[model samples]
Target: MFRRQFLGLGAAVLAFGLSLCGTAGADPLPDLKGRTIVAVTENAYFPLNFTDPKTGEGIGWEYDAMNEIARRLDAKVEWKTSSWDAMIQAVQAGQFDIGMDGISITDERKKQVDFSDPYMVSEQFMLVRANENRFTDAKSFAADPKLFVGAQAGTTNYFVSVSDLLGGDDKSPRLRLFETFGASVQALKVGDVDTVLMDKAGAEGNIAASPDRFKIIGNGLGHDEFGFILKKGSDLLAPVDAALAAMKADGTLKALDKKWFYDYRAAH
Candidate 1:
């Protein structure tokens, strides 16, 4: 969606104008009581999703969103952490009812798994070392063979970086694939990769935490939209949509946005 359209929807949502899904009128929110809804995440999209430092429990924005959805549905949540590449596959295979990582909404993805209303919208940004700024421009990365850009497998950012920046060929800068965003970022720090491309929020949060040592690169990868993942045609999509709409309408989304992404707000 265009920023204008998105902002329009945001206004309507804020003004309580979202219409209920026709199917939801009969769907009855499902009897989620005593039942478990599995949620898949990478635990690498910081603030949006991450593992607790001490307890190792999953915690973050997506985590909080799932918790809210589960409570509204009267269901218990079973969080399943997985590689970013495996998240959509797991949900498509019916291993989980929802995938809550900061997965972007795209036309290609709509074929594999259904997505509810977008919970957040933003662009992709590259993470690079503070001292080096070569990756800030596409022209530099496009010309250099020495600079390697890292992106997780099965993500739109990877595809875009390869097609748009790398010219869909192997002769240009190479894309090093990581199983997780965290791993990819670590690769950057260890000098295994020249830059790591990820969602804007994650990149911003990491940059904020270590402002003296890191920064986001490039003009940003444009209009990335995020939504919860569900098996294509799953019965649960309607209620999930409704809950997300309610969350946005009631200001819960902004509050949660502040909690997780205070320094950088996730686009709506």
Candidate 2:
């Protein structure tokens, strides 16, 4: 399935999005054809969105999950990659049908864009070098702005690090921009960044690939939900929710989670 078929629905999407409003599951999904959904992601967050080490293909939980949802909707997907910061904003700006990343559904983010039902839930966590106990949790990280807690710019982790950890809720992190989470993880391994703010699930992949280099610190900063993001009012949301509902009800979501994520966990 290719994207060209969806042009008509794409145009319909542009015209009707703003007028359509309600929860995702409020109405039944419409029959859609000749529609391609342009989904955006940053292949930085492992297990969710990441470049495959073997074929260099973009592969991860989000990749597989979105493709599955698209199949059920009889829609095709064209994926665009960018820095994590721009992915959400692009969806908000109507540049894409939806954004699929390990995007946490935070209240602050909901103000900017709408989200599907949460697909995966994981605790916000920190990764620090082995034997480095000087810094542990968000509170300790906030004690010193001089310490570099690396995160992709404009992400929830970046926001959390800047406000809740380094600065205050109102402040942004001192700002160390990286092209991807892999680079930031490398920085953490070498101590270039004192810590890396990541989801517990994502950090697990990094830890599996590089043992003795990184470890989770402190209790998780608490749980966060990940979801597919779209513009505030888009026709596409209903079908996505519908597909997700089917996936959730039949245990498909759990099975897929275990396939990509080591543990089987669903975001409720």
Q: What value does the lDDT take at residue 124 in candidate 1? A: 70
Instruction: Estimate, for each residue in 94-196, the C-alpha lDDT of model 1 and write its tens digit.
Output: 9988887777888888999999899998777767888886656777877887888887767776777787668886344477887777777778887888877
Candidates' RMSD to native: 6.9, 9.7
Candidate 1: the clashing residue pairs are: none
Global local distance difference test of model 2: 0.72
Q: What is candidate 2's CA lDDT for residue 5?
A: 19
Give each model's whole-structure lDDT.
Answer: 0.72, 0.72
lDDT comparing candidate 1 with the true structure = 0.72
Number of the predicted model whose TM-score against the real structure is largest: 1
Off by over 4 Å in 1: 1-31, 170-173, 263-268
**TM-score to true structure, per model:** 0.81, 0.78
For model 2, residues 1-268, the per-residue Cα lDDT tens digits are 0101123433343224323333365444455785899988877777777776658888777887788788767789999887776777788999988997787888888898999998888776888887787777777777766777787666767766666665554344455767777787888888788887788777776776676777888777656788999999988988898888867765567655555555312210
